[model samples]
Target: MVSERAAQVLVASNRGPVTYAFREDGTLDARRGGGGLVSGLSAIGTDADALWVCAALGDGDREAVRRGVAEPGVRMLDIDATVHADAYNGIANSVLWFVHHMLYQTPLEPVFDAQFRRQWDAYRTYNRAFADALAAESAPGAVVMIQDYHLALAPGMLRELRPDLRIGHFSHTPWAPPEYFRMLPDDVAEELVRGMLGADRLGFLTWRWASAFMQCAGNVAEDGRIVSSAPDDPRPRIRHSPTGESAFRTTLVGVHGLGAEAGFLRRRSHELDVEERMVALRDQVGGEGDRKTIVRVDRTELSKNIVRGLLAFRTLLDERPEWRERVVHVAFAYPSRQDLPVYRDYTAEVARLSEEINAQYGTPGWTPVVLHVKDDFARSLAAYRIADVALVNPIRDGMNLVAKEIPVVSDAGCALVLSREAGAYEELGDEAIVVNPYDVTGTAAALHQALTMPDGERAERTKRLAAAATALPPQQWFLEQLHALEALGEGGEEADDLGRT
Candidate 1:
């Protein structure tokens, strides 16, 4: 809007739809990225006048911005690299992520020393940069959507700058319960809650997480009259105001379970690259004699519970000896957050476990476990198609899309072994063999059940899973949020369908 091209809808996040990289010849290469958000933005069409604002993450991106490089419908902020690193790595990834996922060891971890306080300041500044940019670029009453924990503070700051703009914030990660969330410094915890409360509406992936957030918000907010709905209520409401005054800060909370785009996945899996990968995976699996395959694809994040999943697979083989040569585990443990020492160690542990399993049960003709660390989308889809059982067990997740995806792309059908902690459990638990992530024995049992399920039953379950999983696709999920924001009238009353789960 500063340049007179005022955008009607704006998206603010840590990463943009476009990224810049340098080729070997030293020329800047601008390439677009794709995901639910990208596809959803595209669905808005040209008339929406959408703009994406994101941080420049690398040297190429910084150079692109400095050289006045441009991408339509996108703006990249060249924040100071050091500040970004401290805020991103120190606070967002280390502190907030750990707390939300309940990853701390409690006895020896989470020492909030002076260094942490400094990083917290940098985090505030990082969020301020985004708020300032959003304020500068937004048209009057523009709908701004801030995403994830990276910009938790931005919504409140943006409200301070431009009160007229309709603001919404969505948390893509689990919301920690009040007890675990209070581990942060009291002042910091207060700031985070107030920051999120600045938005007119807040979204979580499931009712469980949305209710958890309301509990945490009510526990804090000293001056406000915090009115919270019951825990089991699908449409929970939270309003905050001064003790004697009417409700001034009415934040409608909602849960929008984002489903995979079935049409895209079904079409994409049939492409040439995917077909080639399918041939390769099928050859590797060698299902000629009815050998079964269990597929799992995830980054080596701490909360993903990759190590436990591997151990469960090992147990499945150890307890059921007759299945040693009858099945193979196809694991895609891609590297993630390698810059963090903990993540690197976790990834190494995964490799060590895979090697141990192969050494224990693998023969030359049949590898017991085929582990791939590299990221290849086609190969993942290929694995999905060939899988007889799909494993999606995470310690905590906002929503495990893989659990919903495999059913849509499987060649015949796939029995799902899912985690109770995943948001998808609320939707797919009836058809999935659910297990607690911490119970390796139980998870192995669930795996056995999934692998041994009858073909007719597997086909029936997959059909139902696919139907429920595709009920609200990604584009509709995003558009629903926009519609909710637009439906907020000047009178400041809740819409009829504003808080539907």
Candidate 2:
């Protein structure tokens, strides 16, 4: 295994910093990731250098070719395809993600068995692949920041290899309550918690998730000492820093926010054929500006409650006959985890419900529900821009970025109907129309209220929605965590990296 010496900071995730694409001429290009990852790095600034290690997702990566403009100091580690599949499709995304998202059925047995053990070994190997690459690449005294559940076991695995590194692990997803987490096999549960404790610090998206981690540590550690311990110490410090941005301070308002590649998402929008499609759609369905467009976009994942959202939309149309002709619900569900039977079935159910609704209320000139089950970012952005009401109802989520992202770019100033169960609710609760995710009737009523809201009230609410999404920006979120890490300087090398604007 070839290893590089080390650096100041390290980032490890399932997907690498850049994705590779091969061209006809045998040239390659890389596209960076979206969301908080990009935002976080930009916030790291020029002075702070980070070594980012992630698995390459395609053939271009397997061939060890780079496409597009590669960023400085980003290292890509490509793992074997079988190891990737067993670790990702078998364990992390399917098992751990389902557990953390509370997407599984309590009635069905979700136990760790021989097959699970085999996958567990693969999972360990998968994590070790990244850990090995990181250990080789890291500089002594580097702050190793491992991301999400995909590499939950990487912290301990990496620590075993490089004890000198100051490690930190952040969970982007919600941490399940201990009771729910205890479903895992004894060794699996114990090892996973111990794996995370190998870090010097642990970060979570919300205080609720942080509390859950502490509770799990209390149950699994036996020693009640989960968060902190001294050098030769086996435990790490735990902290909760729910991210937020001030709407008044965004680029739109000339205030600094986590500067995203807004230019990128903006340029990508024009390629989607969304504008042309929207015009055709309006002429076909709206009939001279008659229909209100309600948009909901999500990956067809279990926690998204896509099926429930569709049911509510159908119910709303049934309850309010007048809206059957006047409201068009555009549900853009991007396919996710088709390998998982539950996700596959749920996605099919979404399609079935949409078909049922449209069949019940379709006119030769109009369709009540337009459902798109493919992943297309440009179409999503375009949908966001036109939405009169944006429905974001997650059964459970770490944070619903869509709740924040849509309002920032919504051309029509959409009213957000958010689920109280989502972590984003903590920030958007006041401005949004909150509803219980499972209560289809209540959700239906909320949709009705949102669609029928007076223009003056809707405009006021839209302003608040936009404000909440922009407040923290991705750049600020990353800085807050970095500031926290800086405060915990190696044995009193402390300096206030906090109070950064």
Candidate 3:
């Protein structure tokens, strides 16, 4: 049981540990949180007092929520459906999201207006709900950790209620540079910057992202100073928590472990309609059996560089005739943000390229490319299990866990063709075939090399990959943060009371 006397650490984010679903009978079902959420929280262990407070996704969430089973000190606050719709579906996902990912079209340009303001109000309301909950729940001098861009305003909001609270906020996404961040209205940007500044410590995934945040702070702050920096160097005193799995296991079980989607992946993969998908692919490509199945799975987003990847595959088919009989690319691109015209257009282009490649190089026995547009995690895991080569080439990612996940779950000794730009390159680069995301010919050559690598070498690489992927599992990720928080608490008051600079 959590007591008021126990030291508390509250983690606030957009999504919580439980999601609600309405059944046929209209009763609600609550499911445990998946992916990074599970991993990070589990790592904290039982010794430390921690609570994960997150917004309820829907009205069903309140009915579905399993009161106390999720974890220690976990709380799910129910907000209005409109609050989530405008804040998450509107401002956060559609607007600020594209800004951070650099997914906007320069020709069309992004505009902020009354609609944005209304949505921004909802965003504020949602964040405040979490802030109010944390303020009430947190003990004096408690350490409050906020996660991701969705709750950027929560730190300050929480701080207002508990000035003595030791606060920290961590950004999981890539921070946009000053130029890209300037797209937001001046007041909105200022609010975001000041909101995050409420934290005593700020965390980012990489130094590059940290630098970007500092640059944005410089641009928006009144006196051109962030965290009391010199006028010429107006930057925040931010910390880089380049989270990773343990160096020993190659799995995310220990130091770097985020959490296991393995069971989820395995269970889900068994039922997904991949056989029908395989049949459709064969029919579309004219039943080609001798071709290589080069598989790529991603949400259809701008940063994924799906169009460029398809162009590279096309280049390979054009330049190398031998590959024509030996290669088939299976692209499982799930639709994301269809309401956004830019995303809709990008999805169309990906489909157009897939057709052109098949028409140009495909024969009755071999369709050079097969593209499936739907969200199917199980089919994706199944593909990972059998893929001879896995291509994950993102333009810029904080950490593409797929680069790590594929190699762990792959049954065969799969070769990884990764983008140099992906954050996972820091860990998997030694074993992966690195390529420039923009270079079509280069990526094709990498694909060829991955396909042709010696059997002994491939096995060696896979062994190393499996070791790396499981090294630091999800529990470790959470525990490390808790440990850091505890250390701060132990030393914080003494330093403060002493007035040590």
Best candidate, lDDT: 1
For residues 64-129, what per-residue lDDT tens digits would candidate 2 score against the true structure? 533334557677666778888889988998789988988777787576678888888999998898
Cα displacement (Å) at residue 371, model 3: 3.0
Q: lDDT (0-100) at residue 364 of candidate 3?
A: 71
| lDDT per residue as tens, model 1, 225-253 | 66566766666667665346663567888
Instruction: Candidate 2: list runs displaced more than 4 Å.
Output: 1-5, 25-29, 45-48, 65-72, 223-277, 491-501
RMSD of each: 2.8, 7.9, 7.2
What is the Cα-based lDDT of residue 164 in candidate 3? 67
Q: What lDDT, from 0 to 1, does candidate 1 have?
A: 0.89
- Model 2 lDDT at residue 179: 89
lDDT of 3 by residue, 35-138 (tens): 77666766656676778888776667666454432434667777888888898878887877788878777788676778889999999998898788888877
| Candidate closer to the true structure by lDDT (higher is better), 1 or 3 | 1
Q: Given candidate 2, what's the lDDT at residue 195?
A: 80
